[model samples]
Target: MRSTVADVMTTEVASVGEDAGYKEIVSTLLERGVSALPVLDGENRVVGVVSEEDLLHKVEFENDTSARAYWPPMRARLRARLSGAGALAERADEKAAGRTAAHLMSTPAVTVAPAALVIEAARLMERRGVKRLPVVDGTGALVGVVSRRDLLRVFSRSDSDIAAAVEDQVAEVSRWDRGEINAVVEDGVVTLSGPVRRRSVAHALAGAVCGVEGVVAVTNNLDWEIDDVAPYPQMGV
Candidate 1:
């Protein structure tokens, strides 16, 4: 079975309220040894995320005034190069002068459901450029948090377990007898060796095994009776 967010997430997450002061938020993050905290509303629903990057705006723009050093046009150009411009820069300036989580948080947090696959969570983290994600329930209330380390726990499965899973996948995908094909797993790497009726079937089995949870890599060594992928001889008129 595929691993889900619920299987690997940390349920005891450290969070803060929207009205939490900047110092309080920083204390919570330092005490918990976490880089970010979810900012919740009165109903305990996540409304935004307050992270180190958000707080750093204060330090980055501490010396700047309402009328920043750069002129509007130059600031616009800098915005394009720095990935923060126009209204975004304005928001940063506001954050620099802010004291509460509500003023400093990045809103519309990227959250995932409990049933999400580990791979899905990993992809979301990469796409969002976040180190972690808050796992929310149907009501949009915070439930747990999943991090890059959590998703990697899947690879901790025992080699024996991975081998068994690979064998099962091979059986289900190719329907070949146990004696016909075999799997060897070491350190999450799978090596398939044996013979199949066609090259396509061998390739399919390899791919299926690759999808098995905890499989780090797959090595295909199945000899095939037919090379179906090879270009067919051109027909002569």
Candidate 2:
């Protein structure tokens, strides 16, 4: 079975109020050793996220009189000039002028539900280019935080534990003969080898094994008697 976000998330998350000062935000990050923090409202509901990149933009833009001053290289400066990088820097400078989390944060934070699968959370983080995600409830209150490290916890399961789960969950649920299928797990990789009655059964068995928690990868070595997926032959009229 798939592990949910709540199963692997850290409940004690470091967050900041919308009115938190820039210095306070930086202090919190240093104290917690985290790269980002969720910005919360008066009622403690997440509104946005403030990351190191967001805070650094201020320093980068405020110190440079011209984009070229920071960009340095002529070719890179030329590229920035052509690509509207100057406008982006100007906006960053404007943001830097603000002194609170409300002005520095990236709004409409990409969040995940507590009940979401770990794989789903990983996919969201990958797609959004984020290193962590805030786990929220239905009311959008932050309950926990999930990091890239949390998603990798599954791989730490012992081989014996994975083998037992595969036998009890995957093999039994597929309804294939338990004796016919042998599940061998090595370093979290499961190999399902045996014989099934049909091609669909073989595929289903493989899928079931893959869905089991702690399964890093699945190898299907099942032999099938019939190809149910094969198309019927056309009759010559």
Candidate 3:
């Protein structure tokens, strides 16, 4: 079975209340050595997240735009414009005026369920451009937190373990001969090579091996005797 959020998430998470002050949030982040903290309500339910970038906005926008002696150089402005940093700066300026977590945090915290697959959590973080996700229950209460590092723990499994799993779970289940189908694992990459009765079986075997935990990549080099899905030639009278 695939590893879930609960399998590798850190149950002891550093969080802040909605009423936490800016300095307190900074202190917690620095002391805990975490990039962000989940903001919870009175019910301990996650509402948002306050990150180091969120706190930096205060320093970035401390001076008003009108106070500048001269406009930024054309090149600098062009780079900012291309990266959308200009728009982000405007929003940061607005956030800088706030004094508490409620006003400073990014709302609608991106979260995952404890039962969610680790890959799902990784995809969520990638899609949202965040480094971590709060693990929440069905009621949205924070239970733990999962980071990119946690999701990558699967890759640390020994190569022997990966090969064993592929051989037992994938090849045997697919009815492929243990000797015929060679399962070679190296640095989490699995290479399946041999002969199979049908092309479909080869594809299915490869996919199954790919889903195994700690398998970084799958190389299928199975020669098939028959192409089951190939269209047949028309007959002529």
All models, RMSD in angstroms: 3.4, 4.7, 5.3
Model 2: ten consecutive residues of lowest lDDT:
170-179
Lowest lDDT sum, 10 consecutive residues, model 1, at 170-179
lDDT tens string, model 1, 1-237? 999999999999999999999999999999999999999999989999999999999999876665576666776677665875466777888898889999999999999999999999999999999999999999999999999999999999999999888877777755653338889999999999988888888888888899999999999999888788767779892
Clashes of 3: 0
lDDT of 3: 0.88
- Give each model's whole-structure lDDT: 0.90, 0.87, 0.88
lDDT of 3 by residue, 1-237 (tens): 789999999999999999999999999999999999999999999999999988988887677567444578999988998999987766677678879999899988999999999998988999999999999999999999999999999889899888888878564745643336778899898888887788888887888899999998998888878888666778982
Candidate order by decreasing lDDT = 1, 3, 2
lDDT of 1: 0.90
Per-residue lDDT tens digits for candidate 2, residues 56-147, read 97787675667534545788767877899966766687677778999999889999999999999999999999999999999999999999
